[model samples]
Target: MKIALIAHDEKKKDMIQFTTAYSPILKSHQLYATGTTGALISKKTGLPVHKVKSGPLGGDQQIGAKVANNEIDIVIFFKDPLTAQPHEPDISALMRLCDVYLIPLATNMATAEVMVKGLEHGDLSWREIVKEQEGNDI
Candidate 1:
């Protein structure tokens, strides 16, 4: 499964901790993340992640494109709702794209924990089929 991770500036620490806790489960899959968050996670968990530009610099849209193309199966975006974001529109569009693509998204730590636990178990096996099909040539 391909998983995309993103965290607002204020939530980056929590994202790091969450990924660290779930690194074993996450290690079996490909990971993608925005610039700073990806660097931070890599530092903390040593997980290889494809890093894109910072979100305000269009990283969210990059992930959104992957979701639209069915290249990503899940998204864990730790957003701080209490704080305003300069790139709120991009964030909103990314969420909308996730919905449009029928992908699972976790916007908070609690929901992210549930999804990660599901992945740790066998509940996300369906993603393997999707990934296999995606790898096959017609």
Candidate 2:
């Protein structure tokens, strides 16, 4: 499965810790992240992550397009709600696309933990099922 990892500046530390703890499970899947977050994760966990632009510089939009195209199966976005983001519209659009595409999304640590465990336990096997069906349809 293709999974996206995004974190706000304030949440990068938590994201790093979470990724570190889940590196074994994560290494089995394709991972992507916004620029600085990707760099940091790669440095800390040694997991290869496809890096896109910084969020304010259009990273969220890029991921949104992937979601629309069915290229992304899961999204783990750690947003800092207490801070105001200049590119709030892009964030909203990315989130809305996740809903529209039926992608699994985690916006907080608690939900993220569940999603990670679900991934590890084959609870997210439906992503593969859906992909297989799509391939058959074509």
| Candidate number with greatest lDDT | 2
lDDT of 2 by residue, 70-97 (tens): 9999999999999999999999999999
What is residue 71's positional error in candidate 2, in angstroms?
0.7
Candidate 1 matches the true fold with a TM-score of 0.92
Q: Return the TM-score for each candidate structure.
A: 0.92, 0.97
Which ranges in model 2 have alpha carbons more than 4 Å from their true place? Answer: none
Q: lDDT by residue for model 1 over 1-138, one digit each (tens)?
A: 899999999999999999999999999999999999999999999999999999999999999999998888899999999999999999999999988767999999999999989988879888777767776955
Distance from true position, residue 129, model 2, in Å? 1.1
Error at 131, model 1, angstroms? 5.6
**CA-lDDT, candidates in order:** 0.93, 0.96
